[model samples]
Target chain A: MKPTSLLLPLLLACCPTEACEGLVIERAWIREAPPGARVMAGYAELRNDGASTLVVDAVESSGYFDHVMIHETLLEEGRARMVPRDTLEIPPGATLSLAPGGLHLMLMQPVSDLALGAEVPLTLRCGEAVTETRFPVSAAAP
Target chain B: MASTDRSALILLVLVAVLAFALGIHFARRTAPEAGAPVEGMLWPDPPRLESFTLDGADGKPLTEATLRGKWSLLFFGFTHCPDVCPTTLATLRETVKLLEETPDFAQQGQVVLVSVDPARDTPEALAGYVGHFDRNFLAATAPPDRLAALTGQLGILHTRVPLGSGEEYSVDHTASILLIGPGLERLAIFSAPHAAPELAAKIGQIIQFLQDSP
Candidate 1:
């Protein structure tokens, strides 16, 4: 679902805090891709700090990339298949990890090359609540 | 006189059968011994590869002869693949380093990145991508049909996945790394979640075992 129309207000409400009230992001990193690479992958840990479950319905990184979507690499029948994830929910007091060779943020069509140590902003929407964080670009996991 | 001829025919048949049995016995004795079981590797019956031609990063033909005389480690992936491809190539780099450090380990091998997405991964782009990981690493690709011919026999599967629209797509591909023997035969299959140390150790042992066999 294209939730950008509604996410704009949520983005305004949240001031791009790394440690927020409901949900917090930790150890976020964007893997540095080779020059002329059209796509890159980002990973982070999504932790639910509040009593209720945090549902991330959509993701956006407009200025840096054409679009961002949650994708998973599944090893099925000896092949790696990229499956898009529309919604992801984290239970209360639980942490969900997006990592290499697993669930990750598939950032497509970068406006320019993301150099090492560069930070890219990303926004996540969970209904009316929104959380934003910046992920540092690195060759390996941070 | 007819009875005498029949006896001679029976004697000739017995001598031929004895020679056949001896040949089987000697051949079995001289066959190579299988190595110990290694993690993440499957040494099925090695199959001879079909002759196929692909263009290397330098626009030269990379045929089966190019892979002869060296152990070839082949991975099928696209340069645009952001997650799994980089992870695998890095793992392979680490694996190669471990192999080099070990003494008596035959380090005669080449790592090749065979692009499944040739439409986007031009020869120059692929060369740059593989070089970022290691300068010695090689990359090659061909037209879709030629690529399919090579991939089909090696059991490498790849398909283009469209992401949204407007000239954006990702490739879903086989994650296993293939080992080609120096004799141009498919040797082993290494499954994913590859650890550098384990992979290097296993490969070193497998190669040594084969060389020392018979």
Candidate 2:
């Protein structure tokens, strides 16, 4: 078989669809917790460049944690509550910000200690498209 | 006719002078604008807090008496909380740093965290949790009923939701930080989206107002 024919097949197989093409992760960071701390929070800005809305249904970090949940901290009637979210939608041409004291990822049961400046691989699942990213551990502002 | 006109002019002058003096007197007596940093609603007459006994981080008894002779900023949260609790505590730590720069603020001010999940937040756990933010920070907890006694009076609220397996759970609590006067009275509440320097400035204003009050 010609090399051009082989290359065409490989490109077609890799670019099956545009669902995962335009998703970008920016300023992704995980709050560094003290040694022996079991839980930590992650923040980031997820931007969707596709024409359709991107819905993130699940997240995973294989070597670091077995469970990752999306949660929002709501301040209602002067009370603050952390509510679990099943899915977060990133509208087309818009950015979803996960900031402090707002929407964040609840990372639990760390398998090992996470040090500052270390980058951890994170996989975000949205429908059939899975996007892989890295989260850098950073210290909180004093 | 000339004497009559002169008497009228003298009466008008006297009235004008009396009005000017009254204006100065009222201006001095009027209260100053609140200028609180947190935009909290100030109580014209702060209500005295009811007596309730809770355990302090050091195993000492904490009651209304603990608030006497010092200003305190009280927050309700749990050690297991991953986001809001720690974020608020960090902001407060920064606020304390700003306050310490002001004279007498370091000596007279304190930050206390009251755990809503007393079951999981033992004195030791709370101590470690709060100490991570600041060494001088204090933590406390009470039984459900006793905790209600204080939270209810302050209009603070909290609810626990299970995480669907095992004993794991999360507690939703009031994010507002309450300011307690040196006399153990409830003065104001600092709501969420709090800024460190703004909170510190408000604390200074509140302290000045309290000290200047009769």
Candidate 3:
């Protein structure tokens, strides 16, 4: 069932999936990292704009980092595991979010220094019409 | 937005009570002579817990009773950790959520984030930062000398370094999750790659054993 009106405010503030209608990415950001740390995480909401379902197989970015893959964080017996997703799909007019403490993107092998405020250019490949986006690396979420 | 406090406190006491009983159970010399005794395996025996009274979020007294009769996961970290602290804490929150959904999985322990970067992580800052993950988490810190003594005995480590920002700095420290059981003993431990379900399962089984014993 679609979330109720009670969720409208949150959806707008957080996901904004409806606002982006027709397959859009809303508010993608790289949660800040520690000095000299190799791994970093990304979060976003992918909203499907049409009546048809959409499958996002892979993502690409330019001049920031090369490899970006979908992964989910799970804790089993006190150990954290990162499970990779071959692809993520969203139903018609639905938004799928890559959030902290759950499914997210692991951006590894940075091509250059990801200074604060630098936007990582991204390309989300969903079939032929790829949607482009940017994720600004900012201070750790408050 | 839910409270992990009252329920967690209740569960913690229940677990701790059960654990104390287990501590006694393990201490007895045995091979049941006349009775069909309850069956169990000791994954590992726990270490004797020492008592401590220290300051908490408010510069008030916090003591060994602070952990009495409850299983607590204590993590030594600082607020400045841009990655591990938050990530690990969030994982603990998820782990707690997973336990809640488990059938009869009693939430007997608390997740305590103690700031090793005491110079910067004032109790208020520590509390605020940890509350961002889950409200019930205990965010505590003490003076550098005392903090060093407590953490050192626990095998936790911390060291400060100069950041390129001239006066500003950063700290590197040991990041291990310590499991404190009832009777205040340090129980089974977990390293990085903190697995939630498996950890919960083991703790659940431990709790069950603690509950079953007289």
Write model 2 residue lDDT over B1-214, tens digit each, in one string.
Answer: 9999999999999999999999988987895755634455668888998998888988897788888877889999887778888788888999999887666568888899999888887877777778878889988999899888888899888889876576778898888888898888898888887879888898888887767888
The DockQ-derived docking category for candidate 3 is incorrect
lDDT of 1 by residue, B1-214 (tens): 9999999999999999999999989988986665744344444556778788888997788888888878888999998898999999989989888888644433567899999998988889998899988888989999988998899999899988887656677899999888888888788888776778878887787787786776
**Which ranges of candidate 3 are over 4 A from the true structure?**
A1-28, A32-133, A136-142, B1-45, B101-107
DockQ of 1: 0.53
The list of candidate 1 runs beyond 4 A from truth reads: A1-20, B1-45, B102-107
Predictions ranked by lDDT, top down? 1, 2, 3
Interface RMSD of each: 0.8, 1.5, 8.3
lDDT winner: 1
Docking class of 1: medium
lDDT of 3 by residue, B50-118 (tens): 665556875565566888777777887776554456667767877777777544444566888888777
lDDT of 1 by residue, A1-142 (tens): 6889888778767765343456889999998888888889999999998998878988889689988888999988779999888888899999999998899999988999889999999989786566789999998887
Candidate 2 chain A worst ten-residue window by lDDT: A12-21
The per-residue C-alpha lDDT of model 2 at residue B106 equals 85
Score candidate 2 by DockQ. 0.49
Supply fnat for every model shown. Answer: 0.71, 0.64, 0.05
Better of 1 and 2 by TM-score: 1
